[model samples]
Target: MVRKLLFVATLSVASGFKVDQAPVKTALLQLRGGADATQIAKYVAYSTSAFMFIPAGRDVFSPGAEIMPDDDKLLGKMFTDKSKEGYMFMWNQWGVNWIMLSIMKILAVSSGSADFLKLGFATDVVTFAMMFKGWIPEFKPFVVMFGLELLALGKLAFA
Candidate 1:
């Protein structure tokens, strides 16, 4: 099962190169109202990760929810519960990371700077390491985030 998952991830990453094609790029650009293809792809990856976690929001927002079972729940509470320090950590610090990365990616592509892309890739690596090193309370979000990150990494690698 793990091998199958790895293979799928590899395939998805490899397929990111397809976005570079003229037809696909044109369609994506039109779909995004003239946004860069690579940027669109990267945002799709981030959006996919966010969407995957949406289902778990119910558990975190439940009226009786208190102690969290794992990092996912804790992370969710960090968003819904403003009284906790984790809320600030999640919104002010952790959540800002993605926005910053997105800006870095845009600058990297726009300036044709390999350095920025390298930095973005490095940040993604560290983020993945931190996420995976922790215990996984749920399988769906983990797998979805991992897969989408792989796709993003693939595009970043080529960009």
Candidate 2:
């Protein structure tokens, strides 16, 4: 998984970046690890260490939620939950991850890059397939945000 993601990361960079990779990687590494994108890309590509794995329980954020002050803040409150998947799921939806994902898809590309993008698109599909399993709240906003962003990138790659 890590190797595949590393390949994808290399390919994404090879593709092209309207914005660059160095600054982005620098910022994200500061937020998480130096290779946070590699981590996310690895997780998205394959299930790694079982104990280290984080189950992305579906519906942690469902539709039609009211805008009231959520007392529990339980929708995506994995940080304080002390549960198995809470923190993993929450961390996946953070700003740094979002930025990294955006950077991955926005890199330079050529005809030779088609296969890598296809692989990336497939990986994303598998990741989304895990959503809404009813095991955790469906982090709706993040679900839509991350989902649409990747979908859009996949579309760009195919186009």
Candidate 3:
């Protein structure tokens, strides 16, 4: 019982801090063919911060202790953010950050340092908005299928 509890606790902490696109990590770690260590460290620090804000306040996840009122408010806020007006504003803020990180990831991957996948995660947001505002007229799932961003397992339909 104690071992199982410990495993669960470890998993939670690991999952909480796990950011996507690890290729960025490898590129900066190239000591032999890399630039000054201090410079790389600074860059990494900035990139780490950029990642946190990339998803537009994705760090605003609810804590385990806030299982009641806080969780309810958070659900409500997510709904509000999904609304047409809120979605656009939030997406703009998040989209800018995502584009910056994507550029960095692309540089790192194409330079033979890190071979991480291109993390073009924000294209989905724009795609969703298009579908909602009657831009993409289709009855399918509209999966991007590029960066493992969307997964439509079952059948999808718009009514």
Candidate 4:
């Protein structure tokens, strides 16, 4: 039975129905040894900043206050005012986020490490919290993005 199972496993891997773990483990070991910690730090910073910028842009442009339920309270008005920032602020935030994401991608490619992938997972978690905090039901795009990010994180974390 053991021999039969081994043969099946080998055949499955050879046919690409199963991933061969040896090469992946070897690559991960090499990456752990060779990857620069500073580069990984930079990648994480950029990635996290990029993730934050999306909601920041939305806050400045669309301003969730528009869809917020009507309230005569001063606190509600204050929150609304804070959400509606100037156009320049929103544009600059978006531009900076894009630049950071670009830098992070470059660093990730150069480092050839899985650390960046982990950082991406962290970014998604943080961004998801930010989205949930904002409580904006109108932004369906954010929901879709969160779902996709979670899927990617699961794949990277598990595989």
TM-score of each: 0.43, 0.34, 0.23, 0.40
For model 1, residues 1-159, the per-residue Cα lDDT tens digits are 999999999999999877653555567577778788577666755564454333334333442244333655554533576677665444444435544555665565556576766676676666667767764555345555655655665575675
lDDT of candidate 4 over 79-114, digit per residue (tens): 444445564564455556755654554454346456
lDDT of 4 at 62: 53
Relative to the true structure, candidate 1 reaches a TM of 0.43
- Candidate 2: stretches off by over 4 Å: 1-76, 81-98, 108-112, 134-138
Find the number of clashing residue pairs for candidate 4. 0
Using TM-score as the measure, the top candidate is 1
The predicted structure with the larger lDDT, 1 or 4, is 1
Candidate order by lDDT, decreasing, is 1, 4, 2, 3
Rank order by TM-score, top first?
A: 1, 4, 2, 3
lDDT of 1 at 134: 66
Between which residue pairs do clashes occur in model 4?
Answer: none
lDDT by residue (tens digit), candidate 2, 1-159: 999999999988977755554654567577776755434543433222111122221213321233333414644443455455655555455534434443444442222256665655665566566655533444554455446545544654565
On lDDT, the leading prediction is: 1
What global local distance difference test value does model 2 have?
Answer: 0.46
lDDT of each: 0.57, 0.46, 0.41, 0.54
